[model samples]
Target: MIIYTPPKPAESIPLIDLGPSFSEDLAARKAVAWEIHKTARDTGFFYIANHGVPQTLMDGQLDLAREFFDLPLEEKIKVDASRSSCTRGYETPGLQTLDDGSPPDLKEGFLIGVDLDDDHPYVKDGVPNCGANQWPEQPENFRTRYEAYVDEMFRVGRHLMGLIALSLELPEDYFAQGLKEPLFNSRLLKYGPQPVDAAFNQIGAGAHTDWGMITLLLQDDVGGLEVENAAGEWISAPPIPGTFIINLGEMVRLLTNGLYHANMHRVLNNHSGRNRYSVPTFFDPNYFYEVRCAPTCMPENGKPDYPATTVGGHIAEMYRKTYGLAA
Candidate 1:
C-alpha cells in the first residue's frame, strides 16, 4: 500500500526542559522519554533544547574542531585514519560515503572511540580503538581539549541511554553492561561548500545512518542535514542554538527489535558561500555485545523478522563489509 508522505517540516521537534522534569519527577522523565520514543520511531532524528549542555562548551568544541580542520593538510595528516584498522584519523573530503551507489562523501572527519587502555574488553581481538589516541605533538593543547570534550560527550550519551532503557521498560541501566568500557566514537566533522568551477563536487555527506546505538550532534547554524520520516518525506534538521540533535542508530534498532529506528539521512551542499562544522558523539555497544530481539519485544501473535543475535556478531558482519575484516 502506498503511504501518504508528510512535508519536510511536518516533523515535530520537542524542546525538553531537562532541569526539573528529567531529574526530579518520575512522570516527567517518562514523558521526556516517550518524546524520544515517538521522535525516533516516527522520524529517527530530533533537535533537543534544555538538554543541559553548556553553549559555551559547545562553542569551545566547535572552535577547536574548525581549527583542526583549517590546519595545513600535512599537519592534519599526522593522525590519518588509514594508519588504524578502525578509520579513526583525519579523513580528507570525499574519502568516505553512504550514498546509494554514489560517489564518496564530500566531508572530512577526525574519528575517536572511547578512551581506554590496551586491555579494554571492547578493544580485544580484532576490534578497533583498543589503544590510546594518536595525537599531534605540534599542536600543544589539541590532545588535551579533544580528549576532554569526547569524554564529556560519552558521559552524557550514556546518561541518555539509561533514559531510553527506562522508556522501554527495560533495566534502568541496560546500557551499563555493554558500556562498562563502551566502544564510543566522537567525530569532528567539517562540511565545506564546493566551488562552482570544481569538476567532481558533491554533497557534504551522503545519506547514511550511524552504526552505533545513538548519535548526539552539535552543528553550527548553517544547516544542510535531512532525515527521512515514516511517510518517506525528507525533513530538514536545521541547527538550533544550545541544542543537540539526536539520531537513532543501527544498534538501537537491533537491541529494541525494531521498536526504535535507524533513519536514513543525507547532507546537501548548495553553492552557498559558507563553511559548516559539526561534532557528533557515536555511542556503540561493546563490539562483542550480542544485539538481539529482546524477549519483551516479541508476543504470542507476532514473531520476529530475524532470530535473536549478538551485538558483536552483527557489528562484525558490518565491519567485514566496510573495512574488509576477515570472515
Candidate 2:
C-alpha cells in the first residue's frame, strides 16, 4: 500500500552547474562528468543550471501550457489522447495511475513527440508511441513554439548523454550510435490542489520511477515535487529558478547494471493552493536500440542483474501497466 507522507527539506539532491559540460576544455567537461557520476551513484536525481536553454523560450513554453490548459473542455478534448494511436494528445485527470495500489493521479496532461506522417515507416509499422501528434487548434502558434522547444531539449539531452558516457569512463560518443535517431515524449502537466477529502494516497503524481533513460523536468515555482532518498525518506525538490531537475530512469539503471538507480518521486500540490505546472521530456535512444550493461558497469565476478531489452519494448510494457491497456 502507498502512504501519503509530507516531505522534508532536501539535503542530498545536488544542484549541478552544467556550464563546464559545454566547455571546449576536455578537462572542464570531465570535471562536470565526475560530479554527475557521484550524484548519480548516490541520489540518481539532481538539478542542472547553465543548461543553455534561453529564458524566453522556457517562459514561453510555460505560458503556452497555461494557455492550452485554460481552453474549454470541449476544445481540449477534441484531440483526446485515447483517440490517437500513439497517445500524442490531451489526457484528462485520473487517466493514469503511476503508483500501484494508490488512487489515480490528480493531473491532466498533453503529450507529444517527434512528429511523423501517416506514411512514415514507424507509423506504418505501428511502432508503439511513434506517430504524428494530435495538435490542438485553439492555441495560436502552439505547434510552432513547441516544436522549437523540443529541438532545444534534444540538443541538451544529447549533450548530457555524452557527459554520462564520460562519467562511466567511456569515450564521449559511446552512446552516439543509439542516439542517431532518438525518441522522446514531452508532456505538459498541470495539477490542481488535492481536495480536503481526497482519497488516501491520492496526489498530483504518484510515487514512481520514470521509464526512459533520463528525464528533464521544468517545474513552476509553486513546487510540490518530492524524491525518495536511499534511506526511504521523502525530501522536497523545490523549484530553483533557471534550473531543470534531472533524474535517472529505469533504463539508465539497466545500462549501469545497478551501479546507479532510478529514485522514486511524487508530486503533491496541496500546499500550493493554486494549480502547479511542469513539463517533463522523457529522452531516450532510438526505439530499436538494444539496451545492455555497459562495460564499465559490469560486476567483477557476477553478471548483470537485469536482462537486455529494447528501448521501445520496455517503454511499451511500462505504458501498458500504467494505462491499464492489454498487452
Candidate 3:
C-alpha cells in the first residue's frame, strides 16, 4: 500500500543494500533488476548496496572537496558561475537561487564540465560541461582525480541504464543509440554550516526532482537527503559508507511512461555542526535522442497529450531556469 502522504521527514522504511543485484546469469540479473525496479517504481527512491563504488575513492574525494572549499574566498570567487557557461563555477552561501520560495540554501559548490564546443548547441560561452571549467592551479592533480571519478561514474551509470531497460522488459540496448556523444554533466558539491532561517527550513538544496535521466550520487559520512515516496511522503536517505545512491530522474520517468518516477528530494542542513559533501555524475541522453514514447512505454491509444520533445531541448530549458536565465 503506497500511501500518498504529505511532504515531511520520513519515519522509517526498510533500507536494502544493492549488493547481490548484478548477476552473470540472465535470470539472476533480471530478478535483481526487477526488485530494484519495483522499489523504485513504488517509492521513487532507495538505498543501494554492491554499487561498486570504492570507499577510499569516495573518502579521498571528500577530503579534496573540503580542501577545495577551504581555499581563500578570493581564490574561490575567481571562477564564479557568472564568468562561465552552463553555470560552471564556484557558488558561495546565499548564491543558491531556485524556484522554491525558500531562504538561501545552506551550502556552497564548485561546478565544472567539458561538453562545450562551437558546434555543440548547448554551449553559449567558452566553458565546457555546459560551460567552462574552473581549474585549481594549486591542487595539481585535482582536475585529474575529479575527471577520473567522473569517467568511472559514467561507466557505472551506463550499466544502470541497461539494467533499467531490462527491468522494463525492453531491449538491453534501448538507451544506447541516443547516448552516443551524450551531453554529460557531473556536479562536485558540498553542503553544511549554513545560515539559519526563521522558518526552520534549513535548505541545502531545494525540494526538486533531478531534471536528467539518472543520477549516481557519492555521499560522505554525514547524511541529510530525503526523497518523496509514492504517497508524497518523505523518506530519510542516509549514508551507507560504500555505495552510490542512484535515483531515476524525470526524463527517465517520462521516457518509461512513468513506470519509474523521478522522485522529489532535498538536503536538510542539520548535521550536528558537521559539513556534508555529495558528488553526483548525471547520466543523460545524448542531446540528439528524440525523447518520445516507445511502444513498450505507451500504448498507441494511451499517448501522453504533451508533444514529443528532444532530450537536449528539454534540458536546455531546465538549465536556463536553474541558472536564472530562463524567460
Worst 10 residues of 1 by lDDT: 318-327
In each prediction, how many residue pairs overlap at the backbone (N, C-alpha, C within less than 3 A)? 5, 0, 13
10 residues in a row with least lDDT, candidate 3: 123-132
Taking the tens digit of each residue's C-alpha lDDT, what string does model 1 give over 202-230?
Answer: 57777777777788899888888888887
- Residues 98-212, model 3: lDDT tens digits: 4366766666888665535556555553222354477776445988888778777777777777777888888878888876665567766787755454345547887888877
Best TM-score among the predictions, by candidate number: 2
* Tens-digit lDDT track of model 2 for 111-146: 998789999998898888778899889799889999
Ranking by lDDT: 2, 1, 3
- What clash pairs does model 1 have? 289-311, 290-310, 290-311, 291-310, 291-311
Worst 10 residues of 2 by lDDT: 4-13
lDDT per model, in order? 0.73, 0.90, 0.71
Ranking of all predicted structures according to TM-score, beginning with the best and ending with the worst: 2, 1, 3
